[model samples]
Target: MMTTAVPAPAISVRGLEKSFDDLRVLRGVDLDIERGSIVALLGSNGAGKTTMVRILATLTRPDAGTVMVDGFDVMTDGANVRECISLTGQFAAVDQILTGRENLKLVAKLRHLDDPGGIADEFLARFDLVDAGSRRVAGYSGGMRRRLDIAMSLVGNPPVIFLDEPTTGLDPEARIEVWTMVQELATRGTTVLLTTQYLEEAEKLADRIAILHEGRIVANGTLAELKELLPPAEVEYVEKQPSLEDIFLALVGKNAPEGELR
Candidate 1:
């Protein structure tokens, strides 16, 4: 009899736990992300989202449990894990003094790429930053800086990436730009694990979503599956109302008609 081979997950975690002094951040978390897929880890404030990313990225050691990225154990094979993954934290990590092109070149050089300048120019074009690549990053807009930060992370072309609250503090248009870039990355077969507080962001980008609460994953599934977990929608006498976000956007001209106010 012939048997088929099962591919290894891009990222796998089993019974993961972490603690700092008297505080326990993660409590027996488990996750599995398929190769070339995007997964969103959702959680509220102080819900251990950052801690989980830190452990998986090998920046912090988990007190217990196991984490494997592309079949390499995060704890025992940290160097290999690092080589296969790129991480973009909450804040932009680009140097303020360097131009956008220089920032990308710096990362490429650090990774020992043979043609750092060529790679830098390629990514600048890819991220639509060619116009601003020559200007100092300190003078760039928040969206431009964020784009440069992500471009730098791609210098080595790692197979997997971790984006921790990547769109934080950006205006709506800027956030949409970043979202488009992220979608392009996934389409190119990069496995992405991102932590986000925005439900809309997850709904738009993630193939599957996992919610963390009180240090444990309370729910994990696709958006439709998760919606099934909730009570069925009830019939209402009145028309459904728009969300606060919808109202805010409508009032602030975001959703208003051009040359007219609602």
Candidate 2:
């Protein structure tokens, strides 16, 4: 008889809670992010989204409960947890004085990866930074620098990655680029903890969604599951009194003369 291997969760949080003085930031929250899955954490401002990311990243300690990443306890095995995880913040943290290639090399050295130059070159090509590899990061555009920051965080080849608003300052095209990178990472068996304000982004990227409100997980499940919790999906057809597109055509002049109606 063959014994099956029981895989561990990439991230597990149980009764996690945090508070600053009398104000609770996370109140007995529970979350489980499976290996290779992208779980989106959604919430409004001051909703404790960043707080949960910080706790899982081992940057800040939770006041109660436990957080385990790759089977290592975040509190007791912080170093081990750090080894298994990479965290990227909302703002890009690229070194302004260092060239893009140099930045990658620095991270490689820090992570003790072999052949820092080769690894840097590989990531440069992968992230579309081959042309900017020798350019000082200070001269790089916002999107380019953001890409470099994410690339640097991948130096350790960690099993889990925490992305706090990964596309915060990007244009739509750049945002899609990040989305593609994230999907590729997940496909390659990287577990991602994604925090975002954009519902459409979460809809596109998340295998599961957890909504935080007043520091607690108010809802959790797949997109359809959460939607079910709110209200049943309904289809309503209304008679169009000259739809918005018709008005736009009247004002802008329909250059195509006729367009296919969806």
Candidate 3:
């Protein structure tokens, strides 16, 4: 008999549960995030999307279930898990008192990254923040601050990044900028786990999507798969006067009959 080795999931949760008093935030949620892929968690308010992200980031502990990040158990090896992950919450965490360059330097120093100055400068150039890097974060615009905050998260070059509503208050342009950065990160083989309320963002970036409804995953699959789970997937027909059927028809002619026009 030969034994096969299983490649570890970038992040994994099994029978995960979390409750605050009578309000259960998560109920036996299970998920596997593969290495170098982006997985988006989607849901309405109070859907436990952020809670699940927190658990994976090791900020919160589950009442029951096992979580592993980069093959380290989050419960017992949290420090190691932290070393393998980076998290940027909904709000930008840049210190207004510090210059953008200073902020990156701080994060680099804290992460014990070699040559903090060089690392900060590299990120400054990479994020196109070089000109603004010398300006105080307080003087920066929302997008600039957000970009700097994201730059800090990359100081250590962690393999897995958890981005929780990263585009929350960003304008459309800023959001698009962030999306490009995310694509670049994924291209470099970094695994990303993102939580977002914006459907477009998930549709555009997620390799897979999991929808949480009332503390449980109501659906999980690739964007196409989840779309298929809805109803009619494809249909072809010709229309001119724009009748109900014509309205239902798509320009591409592939109609997902299962999914509503959302």
Global Cα RMSD, each model: 8.6, 9.8, 5.9
TM-score of each: 0.89, 0.87, 0.87
- Itemize residue pairs with steric clashes in candidate 3: 230-258, 231-258, 232-256, 232-257, 232-258, 233-255, 233-256, 233-257, 234-255, 235-255
Residue 89 of model 1, lDDT score: 91
Per-residue lDDT for 1-262 in model 3, tens only?
9999977889888889999989999998888888999998877778898889889888888999999999999999999999989999999999999999999999999998889999999999999999998999999887888888888998889999999999998999999999988888899999999999787888789898777766766566776665444344344654323222222123113552333222
After superposing candidate 1, which stretches have Cα over 4 Å from the reference? 1-3, 237-262
lDDT over C-alpha atoms for residue 259 of model 3: 35
The numbered model that scores best in TM-score is 1
Give the C-alpha lDDT of model 2.
0.84
Give residue 47's lDDT in candidate 2 (0 to 100).
83
How accurate locally is residue 203 in candidate 3, as Cα lDDT from 0 to 100? 76
lDDT of 1 by residue, 94-191 (tens): 99999999999999999999999999999999999999989999999999999999999988889999999999999999899989989998999999
Model 3's TM-score against the true structure: 0.87
Which digits, one per residue and each the tens of the lDDT, describe model 2 over residues 36-132? 9999987778889998999998999999999999999999999999998999999998899999999999999988889999999999999999999
